[model samples]
Target: MTAAAAATADGAAAAARARTAGGGAGPAGAAAAAAASADDDPFLAVAVPPLPRQLSAKVQHAIISADSQLSERLSEQLGLPRPLILELMRFGAVHYCPVMPKAGPNTPMTPEQLAAASAARAGAMARWGPAPKLQVPRRAMEDAPATAGGYARVHLQPKRFPAAHTTDWRRRVLHQGPDCVVVDKPPGVQVSPTVDNVLESVPACTAAALGLPLDSLAGLHRLDAGTSGVVVLGRGGLAFARWWCGLLEARSGGGGSGGGGSSKSGGKSGGGSESGGGSESGGGSESGGRSGGRGPKAGNEAATARAAEAARAVEAAAEAAAATGGAPLRKVYRAATLSPPPLGRMVHHALVGTRRPGEPAHTLMLAVPVEGSAYCELEVVQVKPIALTGAAAEEFGPSAFESDIRLVTGRTHQIRAQLAASGCIVIGDLLYEAVSARAAHEAAAGERAAHEAAASGRGGGGGGADAAASSAAAGDGGGGTAGGEAGAAAAAAASAEAATAAAEAKCGFAVGSAATAWSRAAQADPLRAIGLQAHRLAVYDPERRLGDGAPAAADLGPGWVEFEAGVPWWRA
Candidate 1:
């Protein structure tokens, strides 16, 4: 064959091999062509099975009431995600009337029957002066037991409380007297029994501690289950009444007069009122000898009479003060908070209840910074009760601040609600900004990581990096001990371990302990876990005289008393 013909054949053969290797003309080519065809025509592709969307009980009810489109719109308006709304419907969180055509014999009308009856009554409303009587539909769970009315009813499960044995109430006594006892109450214990709880109340625990009957003891003031603080309880009804009267008088700005008078009289009248008359007589005798004696004697009589009248007036005032229960009482508290309020700002915010215009609530705060804490920036605030007045409620924002709170009004959840309205939610307060602190913690953790990273390394960016490195080096150098930085870390770990041990001991729970029986209790009740720092540091009654020339123990009055609890170990 000619050379040109051979070259042409070789080129054609090379082209054929290249086409086969590149998957241009074989099984590979066919597969590629098929994939291309599937891509171009979606129907040719293998179908991806759609996921089954689960609907909750609420979502199911919503869907029953409206179409999917309407449900979606409702969810949007309610600020709920579509998936959550559907899930709620599927779970039957929402209630609806079960499908029924007629009322059963000897039973009330079913929800459907009631609806029909209502419609009929409405149609005949023009003929009658009053609308026809119709049964209202009873709400029920999707999977509830059927009742006599031929409709199901959902009985809500009652909440369970932690067993009394789970809490250790010993060693919480702050002070005890014949009239009253002050207890350093721990968190999670109720001040009084409610419908859902009968045990683990402050009154019950105090009565048990004092070996008195529950009926014999009465609480003077209430502290929330979440708040750890000093609780005062009277030993009997008389004691309670006296203490309550004193507290009311103090709140009403009618204390201190009796105490002040008694103090002044005791200080000045040591030798009796006759000493002043004698002094006047002696001075007149020196001025005019025996002639002036009778004149001075008559003057002394008049002066003595005036003095006696003044003494009688003071005595009457004192008696009136005691009778009216004008015993001065003051409450001091220590709070740990997130925001650092001005050193001495008196917050006068009005708090309203469920059905009335709010009363004025006043709190005097003194903020102090907490040093060297990695958990969160905290301030130690000293709170003193000021005054509560009948005032209109004030508006406030929803931000959170952590502070030690003291209640002047001693109203229900006064500190919690007031502080929340003022935009300072206590840490771990679920009713307020529970999620806020957690979010802040996460953000702080990230910042701390960055800070540590910056501190450990040498200069890389600006003066800030150099300064951080220098500071870290200084800290390392300051550790001067054998382990240096390692020693500091070890110390920190040991401190943390000690704190954990103390917490475990205080809480009466240990790792893997049988406390799990009551573990579900706190989880069932969110209020049990909220962190409210309201420690009653001290309480004072002005009518209770102390120090030199004060009355003996046997001479003390019913409302005259004082009690104090030390700072919490965490703060100490």
Candidate 2:
């Protein structure tokens, strides 16, 4: 019978057999015999349906007589039981040979399942081993090289760190308390010269500048190259160690944000939560409900309380930072941009919290937008030392436009992501400038190739005329870097021309009524530096915004103006 038909027939036949068995078991001695038989006979008791007509009798007979001598003999020969052998045979008849299924496509087995089946077959083969053996001849070992002891003694040069600076310049100190120093670091330099002794970098430079012995000075902290700020240095090793340990502990507790827990603070000294905390507020409690009132009581109140405690801890660290000199050193920054900021634009962003000294941590962020941009920017200045806030929430609510940020923590790559996430990516960013650079490169190469190709043919034609004019401009203009005479001349001329063009373009910007007023005010006043400008991007800032809190254009002041003064070597 076909498989489906066979299945149906087997079911009917099995039902009939059960009825017959049931009726046969009813009388006097028959009941006892049937009960005993049921205990020992698997096939008679099992509920499995029968197989196809020809196969069913043989399979059932094998199972019914599974404990008989014939069954034992068959099982010994097959390495299994009589019932298992019969079932295998029945399955082979139905499916062992390849045949198309009802469906057009074949069903696929999972790789793992297929592999497991293959492994099972292998195990079976192993059980009845013919003991197949194969040999792989081993190669003879070569004699050890002569003078092995001498070779081992040869010293190797210390490996250098790629893309990292190294110098013999180093200074060490031992101190028992906090100390600070102002290092005269070069503008195009990094505070940490090498990873091994991060403190050695700026301190070494400070030693050199002060004409102090190399072993006398020690650096406690670092500043970004473009920052050019005072670096707090400690004196003896013990003292420096104490300060370092305290600083480390403080930052880890989410109290002072820097190096490690950086991105969480969003560049604010007294980072506050939406509910208020840290240098600005206390922790473990919610700010008195605004007009919004209290949220329903759930297990969540504990979580809010915990958040508040964390804020208080952060504030403690800020207090520690401030109290170092009886008061923390105040820092100020100036940024120049393309135009004046819009009338009144302020954007608030949330600063996520990070790990404590003993815990592992990460930052969360939200960006909000603000007012304006011809070339949008903002200046980050460390305002003052304030009491710590220990309230429940540490971040601010979202706003409308893009915003620039300062760093409260020293986490890596925070500032770059923060600015980009806020919507206004910083100008002239190397790592983040992929799209713009690629386009510019393609365009420049195309123009150069076309110009060169044109020059190669037709002497004194369009190319010759252009070439002469270019030569005159390059020779006369003083606007580029030092190279060979022709190269330098060209570079110079290009630099001058670019600057002039930039100024002209911004002049065009001044035609707008808002910008025109800014220009007029600048021309009218001496202290007011007017016109559009760009920033000298710096490294050391790390904090980014995420989610709905990105900065808005409205945050930029009146003219959307910002600018940079000194050249920057390090980047955010």
Candidate 3:
């Protein structure tokens, strides 16, 4: 190997050794080791070729120009740091191609190389196929101080995130495999940190649980903070890519034969039959073996029946595989809301991002009322990869409905936005315009307060005579104002009891009980009381289909597994 490559290998080996030695120290030690092991160690440095002085000068000038006050302002606007912006520019890590403006191939450049480089870039772009690009050294960029004008689309690397809150990984793991791990992500836990916040995320937590390096874990998809559900994480880049592709295929209805919409229902039916056959076979084998004196004809018939069942099982497995296009991904969710939805299947068609009509998005909603009240309903919403025509700017009206949402397309805030647009907001979804449950409690409290004040006023008015009589009695007994004060205290205590009873009736809770405290707490923060109950119900992996037999762990493919996180807390 070349000297540079060999040095890089050595550095990597050193890092591995450090990690192994410090494994007991946990994530902090791993991070420290990585930080200390620089990719280019001066001791192992090789004689690398240097950049031409003229080109270097041009790059330096470009970096100086880009890192200006203007860049800082742009960085703020873009929600990126000023230093990051400069680094991106200096390293040419930004998306745009950097080219010299105008100088010719044989022209003798002046002392100021910036002007020449700009001239060359302009001339080259004016003429043709490819332009002479300006290259910048990464090391130079790293050492450079923050300047102003440099701006680019900053792709920030994931940093070592400190766990923001305590999380139970054992409870979270729905399925774990060599290629991936599926977790029942709790609400309020972020999928990943953003530009501003470096809070703990699902991937980070997964890494901790598995004792793997953070960089080794890749998040295949994301769920919103309020959305509690199954989150899939790939063990590595290759695994993540494969899983992501499968998810896309499933979403796009690219899976052959069984349109993506029908896969869930089909799988359920097939699974039932397969399960039934296993039970029947088990019982038949025990009975037949015990009653071993059957005639040849009877034995032949039983064998025929077993063979037929096996054939059916094989057929079913094949059908499932064809239907799912061999993709190992299925997602289902359960949501809760306040208002009752219109029962049955309803299709919601709209554009995803910009309101201006584009490839219209489609979300199929199936509403079923939750048994209890007319105000609440349970919906099973199926999102297909199908595109519908038309603008959904004003398609749905304001109504409350909870949903069992199955994602057909893994879009950002797909469930929340679609449901909100359809007038069925998930409970505790503050981002959307759903009516708050707290409003009703506030109104009730106001009415109760008014009633109590009026009643107290009436009681005070009526007690005046009693007070005067008590004072007269006290004067006769030589007790003075003390007797009047005692009488006043008794009246106040009676009023307080009456007020408490009235409050119990108003709040629909027993006085001074746990239920009363809970009611008060609910009124204080309705969001917590009635949380966004979106849970991942089940996930199916079609790639792991069994043929006429029970599936063993070895039969499962890379990134292949099924998981089910039961109904959300509200449903239970």
Candidate 4:
């Protein structure tokens, strides 16, 4: 049977078991039973479906009956591309439990035991020592003569996240300058690559679509994965890129926007956006998020000072920049708020360090989560009504008004967290609202729905979230991680919970955790396009000085340019 078919069969069996356990109750009872079963048997959640075009790839898992060449086995059995499989392994997507998961009429775990087991699993995973390479050799328990990390029936799961994939991201290109590629990014797509799936991101796809090398494009500013709008990417090999970077960094030094920074070169930041928790997803981690870069510690004067100093160090280079061709950039975003925002510039400082005793008079501070830091606060510069139409009109619901927000800095989950904290959550952002980054198993519900319809000849249906994953239109996921030894030996012997070590916890966790079911689901979810869009990027010539009043960008004089990626998800 096709992987999809196998998943269907497995789901049927689970649903049937659920019905039996519930004494043949109603559909709701069956559903609850199925969920209970899923906790015991993860396979009920692993459904292989047809890959959608411009959508993300599905999450997958496999059971290892024996041990052989790891990558070869996955590539051959799952029908996934070998190179892609290799990439998954490198990013820690491919995971394994030496022993089989416990399945078949097991006692249901209580919430306490479940929580404890969950913690244990996470701990084991953390110290879970790096996984083996593609060509590593191994033996099952029966084949081992003791004293080895012996395994008979092992459990394995290799997941690929969902990423918005389009061969023509080039067509979406808003502007292609000498050293910058600005594009109207689509919703549900990451601005740049995340730790798990690098190939499906905005920069990577944009580079592929533009016939440029992968590393050629880099982000100067970021948009949330769910937000759709204008993104400025620096073509690092060119002079313009360096100058722009310097300009951005200098602005960071001089306290965000007050005109523009001199165009120069050399600004440090990138590889990925900042990572951390917020009012959205609180975490159980030491750092609160998966960010590898340093962020200001909320209101920590020393940390924020350190951040400012670093930017100042880059200022000299930027100060030397010609104020003309390399000018400062102005950003504007359009969002549908839960309620009308007070009109005017709203200045938010670091949650603690907005102003310090004996601090300089002209000093400016930012909100927590600086550099995606959970500690700092975000500065939402301006919020005003939009000339509404379409989705924006419908989303406003005759109460709240959608607004155009001018930003001082763009960071991950910044808009959602800030807006939600300000008393208006984005229409669909589960991360900051009741749904915490959204549950990973929610996809399992969708999978079960699809399976039922398919079994009943309804052919499959749609309407659900997907992840950020897969380069190919048709990614292979055939015989499962393929059963190596005898089928009976691998028959749900391992605890299904073993397969789920951790979730890419939406509880404020930024792209870091993988191998867990929720991570795949969260990343794959296109529904995550949380009602925010980067509306415009205005590039002003530093040479054109702004007088007492900051005039309209068009009035900023010659050489100044602005790009607007019509927000299709909201108002135009």
Instruction: Using TM-score, give the best candidate's number.
Output: 4
The residue-by-residue lDDT of candidate 3 on 46-125, one tens digit each, is 10111011010111123223333433544556644444444333222332223333445775656576464565445434
lDDT of 2 by residue, 1-572 (tens): 35753454455435534633544433533354344442244333222222111111122111111223332333453344344323222222111101111111343556674454445434433443323221111110111111100100100111111111222222221111223333333322344332212222444445554565433444333333322322334443332223333333353343332321221222111111121111110011111111111443677886466445444534544565544422121222222221222322223342334333422121222345323211112234322212212220111112112222333433322343233333333332222122222223344445444434433332334334555544444463433222332453445545644544453343332222232322332222211111111122121101110112222223232212111223222211
Candidate 3 overall lDDT versus native: 0.38
User: Which RMSD values do the candidates have, in order?
Assistant: 32.0, 33.0, 22.1, 23.4
lDDT of 2: 0.29
Q: Which residues of candidate 4, in runs, are more than 4 Å off?
A: 1-163, 166-168, 238-241, 254-327, 350-400, 409-414, 434-527, 541-553
Global local distance difference test of model 4: 0.43
How high is each candidate's TM-score?
Answer: 0.35, 0.27, 0.38, 0.46
RMSD in Å for model 2: 33.0
Better of 1 and 3 by TM-score: 3
Better of 2 and 4 by TM-score: 4
Tens digits of per-residue lDDT for model 1 on 276-340?
Answer: 00000000001000110112245588656544544443444445455645423434444333454
- Give the distance in Å from residue 255's predicted Cα in candidate 1 to where it truly belongs: 15
- The lDDT per prediction is 0.35, 0.29, 0.38, 0.43
Candidate 1 segments exceeding 4 Å error = 1-163, 252-327, 354-412, 421-423, 434-524, 529-531, 537-561, 566-572
Ranking by TM-score: 4, 3, 1, 2
Which lDDT value does model 3 have at 264?
17
lDDT tens digits by residue: candidate 4, 175-240? 776656778887766554443344456776788788886556766545555667776676654234
